[model samples]
Target: MSSHSHHTIRQAILDRIQTGEWALGELIPGEAMLADEYGCARTTINRALQGLANDGVVIRKRKGGTRVCDMPVRQAKFNIPVVREQVEALGSVYRHQVTRRVEKAPPTAVQKRLGLAPGTKSLQLDTVHLADDRPFAFETRWVNTRAVPAILDAPLDEISANEWLVQTVPFSSGDVVFCAVNAGKDVAEALGAREGAAVFVIDRTTSLAGEFITTMQLYYREGYQLHSQL
Candidate 1:
C-alpha cells in the first residue's frame, strides 16, 4: 500500500466495484478516506477517481460526491477537436501561427511510437492557437511523411495543420491519451501560463491501413476544460 501508484489504485478500485464490494450506484469512498486506506496521497487517489469518471465508470458531483454510474458506458469515442472550430464556437476570433516547422529526424521516442526506421525523416511543427488574440493551446506534432506526404504542401501559417489534417486526411484507427502536466518553459510561453502551472495535454496518433500518420501533443492554456458526452 505504501508504494502504490495511482494506476494500481485505479485497478484496485475497479476490481472492488466488479466484485460487488461497492454496489452499482453506490457512493464510493471519498478521496481522503481512500488515501488513508491506500497509504498514498490524496492527489493519487484523486487521479484514480478522475480516470474512472472520464471512462463513465463513476459520476462526480460537486456536493453529492462520487458514485458508481448505474449503467456505465463501456465504450466511448472522442473525435479529434479542431482548434479553430473550438475558438469560433466560443464566439471568439480564431487564429494560429506556425511558430516552427522542420523536416528532420524525429526523436527516438516519437520514431518508435510511429514505428519508423532509424533516421527516418518526420515533419515537425510547433503551433500556437489563439482565441481573440490570446493564446489558447500549443500544438507540437511529428508527421510521418511516408503516410501523408501531402502535408508538406499545406500552408500551415495560413491555416493550422490541425484544421488541414482533419479536413483532408482520413484515418481508420487512432489512439489518444489525456493527462495533466506541469508547464515547461516552451509550453508556458506559448500558452501564456506561468512555468510549472498545471496544463491539460492531449497526446494522439492516427493510422490509415496500418500506416501511422502522425503523433501530436496539444497543451492547452490554463483553465481549459474538456467536455465530452458519454
Candidate 2:
C-alpha cells in the first residue's frame, strides 16, 4: 500500500466515528477485519486505530480490541519539544547537568499523582538546563521504574531527562499544566533568581497503556513565556 493510505484510512475511520456510524461505546472491527474491508495490510489499520486512540477518539485494548470512547476527550495535539531544541531554537548554546539521581520512595504528592502503592519506589532526578551558560530551567522529575526500567541505566548527565524521555519513550496519553509560582530557596538558587520571585511552572504527567511513566515539574526563571501557534 502507498504511504498516504494510512492517512486516508485514518480520515475514513474518523468520519465513521463523527457521523455516528460507529457509536460511542461500540466495539469496532479488529485490525484484521478492517484491513480486509479496506484492502490494506493489518499494520495500516493498526496505525489508523493508534492515531485515533492517541487523540482520545477511541480506546484500544490488547484482548478486548478497539472501541469508541463513551466520552471522547478531544486532545489539543502539540509536539513535546526537547529542552535542547527549545534553547537552540533561540540561537543559544544548550547545556544539561544532572544534579541528583536516586532511587527512593516517592513523596506523598507524587505517589498520589501516579496512583502508586504506599511503598512504591521511583527514580528521582534533579536537573538544571542552561542556555548560553545561564540558567534556563530547573527540573524535578520522577520516573516510574516499573513502567520504564531502562531509564535507570540512562546517562542523564549528558542528556537532560526531558530530552531523553521524549526521544525514547512512547507515551499514549499525557497532560501538561502551566502556572505561575513564587520560587522557593532551592528553585531560586537553581535558576539564579531571588527567592519569592515569580516563575513559570510546567507540570506534566505521561502514561503508556494504563501504566504510569513519568511526572515532571519544570520551573523557568522570571521573564519566561511559552509561545505556540495552533
lDDT (Cα atoms) of all candidates against the true structure: 0.83, 0.81
Give lDDT tens digits, candidate 1, residues 1-230: 48888889987886665445675567988999999998999999999988877656678898888987654122225668899988998999999999999999998999998999999999999999999999999999999887667778888888899887765554546799999999999999999999999999999987643567799999999899998765
Tens-digit lDDT track for model 2 on 1-230? 44547778987887665445666678999988889889898889989889878766688999999987654123325566578988999999999888889999999999987879989999999999999989999999999987767778778887788977765555557788989999999999999999999999998987654567789999997998898777
Any runs in candidate 2 off by more than 4 Å, and if so which? 1-76
Q: Going through the candidates in order, what is the number of backbone clashes in each?
A: 0, 0
- Deviation (Å) of 180 in candidate 2: 0.5
TM-score of each: 0.67, 0.69
Supply the global lDDT for candidate 2: 0.81
Per-residue error (Å), model 1, residue 3: 62
Worst 10 residues of 2 by lDDT: 70-79
As a TM-score, model 1 comes out at: 0.67
